[model samples]
Target: MTELRNPVIRGFAPDPSLVRVGDLYYLANSSFEWFPTIPIHRSRDLAHWEYAGHVEGAAPGGSLAGVPDSGGIWAPSLSWDGERFWVVYSIVRSVGTPYFDADTYVSTAPDVSGPWSPPRRVPSHGFDPALHHEEGRLWLLNLQNDHRPGGRRFAGIVATELDRETLTPVGTTHLLLQHDRLVEGPKLLKRNGWYVLVLAEGGTGFEHGVRVARSRNLTGPYELDERPLMTARDDPEWPLQKAGHAELVETPEGEWFLSHLAARPLKTPEGPRCPLGRETAIQAVTWDAEGWPRLRQGNARPTITVEVPDAEPPAFWGAGNCARSPHPPAPDNAPPYYTLRSPAAPSWTDPTSRPGRLRLRGHHGPDSLWSHHLLARRITEHHTEAQVTLQANPTTFTQSAGLLLWYNTAAYYALDLTWAEPEGEAQHGQQWQHTGRTVLALTTRDENETRRAAVQEVDADTPLTLGVTVHRAEAQFWYLTDGTRTPVGPALDFTRLSDDHGTRLRFTGAMAAIHAVDLVDASFTADFTDFRVICTSV
Candidate 1:
């Protein structure tokens, strides 16, 4: 058997479900709110991977409309039952919603590079569904809600046999295992004549862990492991605490390995911080002399390299640079001219007035926010620098236009041009609100916070260029006004914004745009040119 490497895929690729079809290996990861959710990658060897395709086309919208940084896909399990490729995943509007309302669905295709079928919701009332096939019969194992008459606070595992051909449930649903503890992310496997059910428990937080239960019969009184297969308490060096939601696979060479999500905490004295969210890692799995599985490393930290039987292949996924075509290049690396978040009105129009420019019709005030007029691109890497040039005239006192780094409604950073009439200057002199203009704003369920920093603002009539760059791991921000670059704020401790709880700065990935607040019934138009995104690959 050959050894495997750590983090074959990195950065936001969590809740891994791996399947090896012959010599080729495929992996799927969770894409919380990012569109084209469920990123799929293919590898000839476990150590090298390439972006194969996305599970779903665009992010689900309408009744299925994806919520900004909220709705869309979650932990997905991918498998091949010798005939077709199947992917099962959960879709939810919000985290706190009832489980029954959150639906689980499946998509299949003859091949992985697929003209995949539209999602069909499995008749299951849960999230994170895993399908297992055994003895010529198919079965579905998933986490069902604890909504019974007087049940536990969280859900537990439930199973039902399904028709092998139709992929439909065939028998009555049976509760396989129900503990008072919160249990989810169940994967079933048959080993050594015993049906083993592996699951994640303790919620997906610092308390997370992986446990196992076994039963002689497919649906009987199963016995749980005296100890969890993996836990943060067992190994302190593990970069992430609360590591769970695991799937095991064997290489073509017959070596066993486990892939799971691990959180990397912000190295702060205050405690662990996870702004970027959980990332995926792999480790060797070994069975003791007694046939029970043990993680070879004891802890969850992934090794950097591994040895495999097959020769290494050349890199495939992200070698070339992506360019913006069809549209004119943005002037500086500033945000795009217009951006919309679940638009209420049709305010965006591609107009001939500016010749090859997208125009946004400004509405009344910030209260009339949420209209669709924003232009955005995916911000996947940690270090990104962008710039844009804009010409705008504000007629209303509330009218403003500028660059914004947005992650849904809750977290954002913006630099905008606001018009203010001086105290004694009548209605003649208008001041460009420059210093104390940067908006480090966040809106959470509990409170809304905005930290204003000084910036050199460009006046209303002149066309000005603005740019902002984010170096993620180092937590630094650089900005340029009119073409001269300068650092902004004290280097922000960005690691605090990781997805793990603690800091309020939730990293919902990054997007840049230029937008208009309430305009007090006046027309505001901005021409944007030369939009660019630059980054270094992992």
Candidate 2:
């Protein structure tokens, strides 16, 4: 028997779409504002996967510049005809104001890895564009935003025919399905002479679920399934609420599976929020005798462990270890900046430098999640650790530089250094003022403290090396000066740092970010000499 694995892809891989070409399988997911949106991964067996390539590079002129914190690549769909491979996705600039625009773009490559052509915008008015080729013609399926007077946010799905050669609309669009409530991530499939439309409804939240509709014609006057295909209520103990945004694929052996997004809370008892954001999960799919699809059950719940074939010898995996000259990893087709809550400038990050350094412009106070020029990457895994070296002279008590784990405007954690006041300032000097003498501090915002730090103090920073460790079990903050360890109060509690129910960290993702804030008019920069992640053994 063949077994399917869990989390076929990890770390901020949301809105998954998959396609199988011959003996190989390829997957693509949302990339949001980060350039090179739409990353593709390949796998021979459903288990082990490798990064294949990206659809487009960063938007021209950095159109997404200064706009950080999760708002770029949306849902993307991948499809393969007998000849070429195609990828379609949406781009949203921010979370508010015309929050989104449905611009469907397409790119084709003879193979997954290649000189991919520049993306061409499909002349269609919809989001989450999906391609379905039947006979000799191409059909486009998408989520139609409800724009009627006093209409709802997302109303329904739309379908239209496209020229097979150019992939351009050939005729007028047709409304395939509409439910004032059901919206987003629409995927179309054909089975046993019927066209099936799958969608996610209830706004990707704890109440989110997958629903299906069927029709005999491509332009559907469809019928809804009496029940949802999947839902968060499947298991009460499991905190994952929204378990939709799925794509279906048939394995080489003719078996089937569903790839979708699932969240797990950080703390179990009190249900800690997720720090890294929503992650991808996979499950085996089986069709009932009636031709309806059903998921296998064994008190079924999302898990980290999935079974697949073993790796062959001479695995040819990518390489680059710590202490060696760092290899330049490809840029993710998603946002790479860590964001603060303020509307600040974009941080300066040098990804090409050996042991690259990140320079953050200074800002005031702790409210840095909304808009601060901070350099960050999206956090995706359950258990991960990262380290960096910081160099800055805190001339004023207000001037400081350090590392942070940011999640939008309301939640985050940081470890930074502040300078001590000049000597004789205690009694002889007039009025006390903040100084940048380099004192170590740890700050966090969670359900318990809200915005206050559980642990904050003055510590030595003579050497300037700092490390932040995030274990599946806990989170720790440590610092080293001249290669000697300086102890802080204690390891802060990290049990509540997950997106189990998708609330606390509104976005269930995290990044290794650097920031300089509230400094006293001096330029402060933090050089990250060594940053490494040690993945747990499988």
Candidate 3:
């Protein structure tokens, strides 16, 4: 046996749905507003995991345009029906209100990395939907939402039988369970002639946890467990916080394992901030004499390590929180590249425009949800460094390209290369002559205001290399020239780009991104090469 770390898959991977087909285990996580929705990963030993692929065409109309942050795809559940894989998820539009305008959909694929079927709208009670197959019959499970004022947002758990061939409701909806506190994200399994229901309790923040219930009947009353199966709320200082939204899968040898989401926060002067966002974790589980599930660690808190059956590690293992390149050294796995609100289409983003370079045609800026030309990857570790060589000819300030540390539209830090008026000259643009110089500007934005941190004029003929190093709560931007690195901006507060810093509803994590903006005519283009990111636990 070997001890596996708590977060088998790290970074902004939350709402874990685990399933086993044959000897392999496949996991899916929520993508929110990011494109290539519902990323999938696979592992042979539940210790070393690698990126497989995402649910292709999962987004309706192949786009999440104008979807609010943390409001696109939520709590994706993955299941295997002996022949193909089924995924159920909800596209949430409105949040932080009584009306959670949302729609749920289902899709199937023969392989994890697949040509998936077009997503078909299904019966939606609420988000965190799942599909259960028992004796060749399909059942849909979801959180029933009461959107009316003074109504419980999480009303209860509901179930409906669906026709397997067309995925249409076949019977009346049944209310399975309800509780005084918030309960959602339900997964069901059969053990010892009893139907076991697993749920997520509280919210997805510090007070999150997993609860269990059992019933002899398929859609009837369930007995809630005396205590939570997994949580870290009791220990505020524990390394893993917000432990909840879990599912269980049994190995061929009858060993049970639970997959859940947890967050590791940076203890800041004000409070704890989870900049990397909730990640995917696995825990060993055992059934008690009463047929109730419990964590093998013998407590509600999540363990940092778990013992699992021995297996060979993947080729891309590294040190410090198991940190490795987002793009693995091996060429077989897909890199975790994501775009905001839209899929990476040839009309806006092109990798084949130039050899070894990614070319992005500018659209709206980062704040625009309808047309944002941003390409990014998750910031897996607190101590991370990212750099890229940019080639762009920005004739005006409206056209710019840069490296950025982004949390959402309202929170980010950017180092952009654009045309600016010469020192001691009029800041206004002279559109006809373009009387300006190429400059690198560092800007930071939060909910309060947008601030210009610093600026440096540079030669327009040379390709510039921009970089940022994030050490916990602080981020410093710099540029490389003549084999020397020069700081362009003072250390800025990286903690603001976090879920806990803003007052409004925030869910997604920090990302290292490269984006372009041309508010003029959406015709400016930027070429980037040698983009690299390295992350480590500090």
Candidate 4:
């Protein structure tokens, strides 16, 4: 028996929608305000997964700028008709408001990593929208969010039959089910003689769980199952917590699995905070005599490991249908890199500038939600190290760049290289400025409080190496000076940059980023090379 891990895809990946086409399985998740919207992952065996590519132009405007934190692209539904690939999602401009201010769009591609078609706007009932295809018709299933002052935010599940050619609703919308409990994330399927509707019930907190409803007709009165299909909400001490938002798929060899989202939170002095954010997990499911799908017979609890059927690799495993393999044994085809707000710009982050070097051009500071000239990756582990070798000479204090450990605008830390005047040296703006020297500074931000420690008069010509080492819940920043390891700022409480610690409900994890910003002119460019990140304690 081959055992598989709980989180098949880790680090800030949530609201997973899975689909299996041929021998390869593809998964898509929400991106929120981050760039490269709607990340699609590829996998053969349900347990092992890797990044495939993102839905290019998933956002209509080529930008998600100005969208608040936790407010861009919500749950993206990835589906495939007999021919091309279809994706439907909502672009959320606001959160927890009377007016959700969200728009739904649909896009198609011949392959996963697309030359995707421009997104076309659809009727925005609410978020977590998914497409259901059957026989010769297409349907859109979504959560009806009532944004009124006093209303059941999660009213119920609704469906609309769409025109197959235009992917637009052809007739009136249907309210499939209205439940008293908090139920959303609806996924539909037909088995044997029953039409099963899988749903994520309870809020996406410690109360999260998977529930099911079934009916003979596509649109009708549905009955909820007495027991939950899968969850770890009741077991707080469990390794996997907050498991919900699930989608199921059957293997070619007659096996069933549920792909969902779960989180690993650390116990802190204030409370438990999930620094790695919600991740994608898989649970092997079984059907009972009553035709209801379940992970277990009696009680449905998520497992840390499950045995999967053994199968040999097929010729098309990494071929035409799969589009860019790297599906597990290989490093994800979608490189271990990402940008914020807008997509990774060639003008801002140029990896081809110098051989093996990444040049980051500064645009806006870390606080900017729209145009952040930053490139980062998800912080997957508690104990990890992030370092970069940078060659930069900032002429003014306004221009700076270096390593960043970011959660959101209000919570983050940075170790940057910039120019600072000597002690007792006076300067006025850019004019009458006293000669200053290059410096490496470690700055930390806890909510609105910002503190920094600097090492000025450093070598301006030679490349400087800056690093951050994390162990357990603390992170210490350091810089290599004169061949000596010198700690920069005081040890920071890493738990502060967590989802629960923030003022708002955050859905993404802490990210290790490298960025440059010229608050003055946005002209200074920084060259970074030999960037490395290692997880010592996973």
Clashes of each: 36, 51, 0, 0
Say which prediction, candidate 1 or candidate 2, comes out ahead on TM-score.
2
Cα shift from native, residue 20, model 3 (Å): 0.7
- The lDDT of each candidate is 0.60, 0.61, 0.87, 0.80
RMSD of each candidate relative to the true structure: 6.2, 5.5, 2.2, 3.6
Q: What TM-score goes with each of the models?
A: 0.77, 0.79, 0.95, 0.93
TM-score ranking of the models: 3, 4, 2, 1
Per-residue lDDT over 482-531 for candidate 3, one digit per residue giving the tens place of the 0 to 100 score? 97889988998888888889788888899999999999898898988877
Against the true structure, candidate 3 has what lDDT? 0.87
Q: lDDT tens digits, residues 368-423, model 2?
A: 32335565555545566666677665655567777766554345677877655444
RMSD of 4: 3.6
Highest TM-score, which number? 3
Tens digits of lDDT, candidate 4, 1-538 = 4677777666788899999999989999888888778888877777566666788888777888888878899989999988989999999898757677989999999889887999998888888888988988999999998877788889999999999888778889999999888998899988886779999999877788999999999896788899899888777788888899999899998889889999888888887778777888888888998888878435677887887766542333332111222222122222346677787765443435466677877778878876887877677667878888999989888889999888887788998898777766664565224677777877777776877755545676989988898786888888888877788868888888877785676777787889999886778899888776665435
Cα-based lDDT at residue 472, candidate 3: 92
lDDT string for model 1 (1-538, tens) is 3455454554456678888888888888876655346767777766656666666442334223334344456778998988889888887555544433566777888886686788776766577788887767877887877656675545568888777657687979988988867788888887888887878877776777777788998886788877778768466556555577787777766677777776655455656655445656666777777666777766434444546557466454234222221011223322222233332222243333444454555553332223434565544346666666666765445666666555554455656655544333454433344312222222122115555554443344556566666675453344455567755555554443345433332423345555566444546665666655554444
Candidate 1 similarity to native, TM-score? 0.77
